[model samples]
Target: MDVSSTLVFAGIILVLLWLFSVNNSSKHRLPPGPRALPLIGNLPQIDSNAPFKSITKFSETYGPVVTLYVGRQRTVALFGYDVVKEALVDQGDDFTGREQLPFMLKATRGYGLGISNGERWRQLRRFTLTTLRDFGMGRKGMEEWIQEESQHLEAHIRSLKGQPFEPTFLLGCTVSNVICCLVFGERFNYEDKQFLRLLNIFTEFIRFNTSTMGQLYAIFPWFIERLPGHHHTVFAQMDEVREFIKKKIQEHKETLEPNSPRDYIDCFLIRMNQEKDNPSTEFIYDNLVSTVMNLFFAGTETTSTTMRYALSALIKYPEIQEKMRQEIDTVIGQNRCPNMEDRKSLPFTDAVIHEVQRFLDIVPFSVPRYTLKDISFRGYTIPKGTTILPMLHSVLREEKQWASPWSFKPEHFLDQNGNFKKNPAFLPFSAGKRNCVGESLARMELFLFLVSLLQHFTFSCSEGPDSINLVPEYSGFANMPRMHDIIATPR
Candidate 1:
């Protein structure tokens, strides 16, 4: 209680912290990587523009598991299927923590399902999956929603009358509408100004996250957030979406039914009331809003971007697209709407869709994981608090698994008999516990949307198939396919 006693206690705490850091740093045999400088720490060595390639090249030299320092943060990079699988699958328990990413932390304020760890994460993730499933995410009811949405998409595209138009917002509107139906309990019109603005904001948020500035913000957030930039704009834009979610939550509270919850928000509100008397419940206002934002933010752009990328792929490879159409036509014909059941019957179409996802490698740097404690991986110890990149780009493009890892090949998912085959390394949704919860929904969306589009129209670009580039226009957090204007000739 005395001044000297207080000073002595503080001294012991600092000493313990110092000793912990020193012991972890000096004793642990870290994975081999480029040596770091004092403060910069390998930032100079990493290619900011195409960091994933730089990482892949680094893995080639340093082996599958490599250590790198982005800013002062000590991070481990896992490359290839064996190393990534070994950590994410075999060592799943040791690698379940999601780092409090500064960008996401700023947006969600560490309240959402995505940015949470431990108890909060477990609770939110369990509740989110159950709530979403109950509302027909990846179920027959949801398939009906997507099927109806596909008809709207067909009409929207057909209204273009075989003329050229950018499919970015079209894909976004269509995709966001599905999540809207699930979360908000209603779909927004494709031409709604507010809805379009929200979609644009989501698109902008993703673009910023995939830019050099976005990576810089992640590394130096304190400085980045202070300076004038689009990060502020992105945050403000996110506020609009959050405010919109809040408004929906209020509406749900006004008319929520106990037994018949309509959507994700409604179910969450109902559960919040159920857990109101419980002291340890995670069902509060902050978690509700953030979790809804998590689902809406995640469910929208990733699948839409992948769908847009598939359009590019289809445009690039007309023969493959045409063949897929033949398979679709044979399976369901142009009149009937495609469903999840149709996925099996239409093997070639399924193969093409899978190939598009595999080739796109959307989230190249799977949201970085954190070590729960000092964990040993492949004879190397990743220190606690270290950011871990499982490098999904490596898994999706690992040469050991895929025959042609670099090329866009539907045969990658096809057997010699042309039946759809599943490869263990096709990990666009990633693997293990923290793998995408919306995997089933995204898969269903890709199949139903793409099949429906191909059923009605033939996709083509003014520049022709030769001009269609499959390479991503940007690559940092996500590998966004280059945007293109294409015409759809109604079949």
Candidate 2:
């Protein structure tokens, strides 16, 4: 253990790390990128606060399809509308693989539809979509559930009587209840402590997962796991959510009616029974628990977060809020409940909602895709096991696709006639084979809930519209809006 001996050991370690980087980098016809350092790779070049911006910057030098390393993980980021669409839409079969992010893998214990691949994914996705459709995910039954929840939401806000309140958990309760109706066949009262506690856990879990520490955990999980931080607590809280889902599943099993399924759980349980004889069937206890967790997690947060951000955007631009209200008043009137059928008639309102999603740019990195096998895309050989990121931020804000990509302009989604126009780049739900399974459900919830709120009340905060910041509080994993207190005055 002399000084020279220690120096020899350190030299050997650096050499091994250098060899590792060379093997990953120089082995294939990988897309061009900045020269990565050993072990840490291109992480030093990335901005922790806005990693998407850093990745987009790489495209400036490396072109639209660029390869870079995140710690030891090799990532291929697709930028701009053309590159992303070409990879995710044109050659979808190759780009359809979902990256089983370490945080999510640990959360779901590698069993849910969110991170599963191949047979498990195909079976669960198909069955889940079919069951949801049968139970009216995008249909009249689902719309009714959202409308009912909107009534509860309005009543809760009215109880405040224009007193300023933070809408974070309130919006969470409203949106989560809609999913509860679909998945658990019941919705809890807003005052239910257990339900409220679970919602709080979800908020923290997402915050941690999108934090710099969370990104670090994903990059160097082996090292980070050995150390200590909030990651452990996040996983433990996720277990609590899973336990809640398990309890609901057990209740559904007790009340099991083979002939008639009451909700998503009932439908899944019935399927489990039908597929019991098959050895390879994906319907089982683990898949059931994890898949329900997936539905609950995905269904609850994104739509609710979008609505929360929408309110902030409205407060930031009161003119937009007033315009939406004027349109809603004209199309549906104040007395009638908003429905999906009314979306077409309320074009300006629809455009505003669409603009909110585009402006918020949640899930900017979309869920990372993986290469199941070596493949040629855009003349680059993307090696097997490479993580692919079709940056939705790039598509949503690409200059070629959006006239004013950086601005909060509802006119982006409107024609000269002011009719709601469709833009190919408006991909808040993402696109391609692995796009969000809950897209239809989310769209229904956003349209109905927002319209219902505007129909009943006008949203504003105490600090005035000038003080409101439409920019997100956090921009990694998902763009999390900053929480604020706002008044909801009855119209």
Candidate 3:
């Protein structure tokens, strides 16, 4: 009953109460995941060398919804179609916000469609959809642009004359030009220095994104931003892209007539002026620059990489390539370029392209989403501000979704009667409101470009039959195939 004894007893009680509360809160908030060490959290559990593959393996052991604490934040990962669909489709708006990664936020300033969320996201996304539609995306005009670009790509490849050359540049050029046509109202010639420089910046940004320094920056941006490293180089590259977009915007503003919009930049400028006085307008110059940056960044690498894989896959499976060529010849012939409408009649070719996307599954884990409010799923509570990562690759390769998820079978997309069948689980572009804005354009480009090239030539491995490697090269952000030469001989 002495004063010192009373103080000691009170301290013990306080410690016990704090420990009890911590234990209970951790149990309810956290999902099933591997144990983490102090400070690093589950960083060591992640294989930085091959993050996607590592994450996929981790999901297998931890079930579909696995939580990992990285730095100060906890990320809830949803694997398989059922889980991803339920969160993205069944409960769309609840998980529409994006996790604010330090590096991305610094670079984008929480602008643009990719990383920005909430009201800004709504307005930008709606405007983008409207502008894209007005510009003829998913329509005949856009199809014509794709067909033209596909022919240009085919001609460039044909000029290579089956030599041992890298197709990366050609593919990037062709793919970027599609966006160029949309945004700038003109496509650049292959040798244009400005276009080449822009592509170089894009490549560097992608390369930097997959670097360890980039990962470090995301985890500890406060420390990394002050230090000198590849993060600076990455930021510089992003700035270069932004500058290019800004220059184009300036040009459009000076030349574009308000009464008639010529391209994406013009449309954006007009909207920016229209919303200048509005307090909640996200249509400012900075957002416009970043939006265009996102378009080129997302639009180019993904479609180009898929096309590269398409050719590589064709070389690996020559019989399938030959069959596709035969189908193209029978359906569209070689006199004219392949068009989007041709997709209906060319079921085999369509199936092959679909299989390419499914097999490759670009953007494996989609750009992360953050919960704006408390949400419950499968008896677990996902608290507000919790990060949700929809494992798109897992969904694409889910056993319940596809009969041969691991194999490259075009028949998975074909019916018994040999017609192209739509699979609900085919979500390479993702699902819900935040799905890829370029989905329609990307589809048209892939279908038209693949069919056009196949119509003109046959792709065969330059290496001996035994030396082909189907495993993709762990490139920057996207999963690119290993550098392999292919002979594109005239059919």
Task: List per-prediction Cα lDDT, in the order shown.
Answer: 0.88, 0.90, 0.81
Q: How do the residues 49-83 of candidate 2 rate in per-residue lDDT, one tens digit apiece? A: 98998989999898999998898788899998888
User: What local lDDT does model 3 show for residue 223?
Assistant: 76
Query: 28 in model 1: Cα distance from truth in Å?
Result: 1.7
Candidate 2 Cα lDDT to native: 0.90
Cα lDDT tens digits for candidate 1, 288-388:
89988988889998999999999889898999998998888888998888889988898888888888998999988898899979998898888888999
The list of candidate 2 runs beyond 4 A from truth reads 1-18
Give the residue spans of candidate 3 off by over 4 A: 1-29, 475-477
lDDT of 3 by residue, 344-416 (tens): 9999999999999999877677877898877888778777767788988888888988999889999999999
Query: In model 2, which residue pairs have backbone atoms overlapping below 3 Å?
Result: none
Off by over 4 Å in 1: 1-24
Error of 1 at 148 (Å): 0.5
Cα deviation at 140, candidate 1, in Å, is 1.1
Which consecutive 10 residues in model 2 have the weakest lDDT in total? 18-27
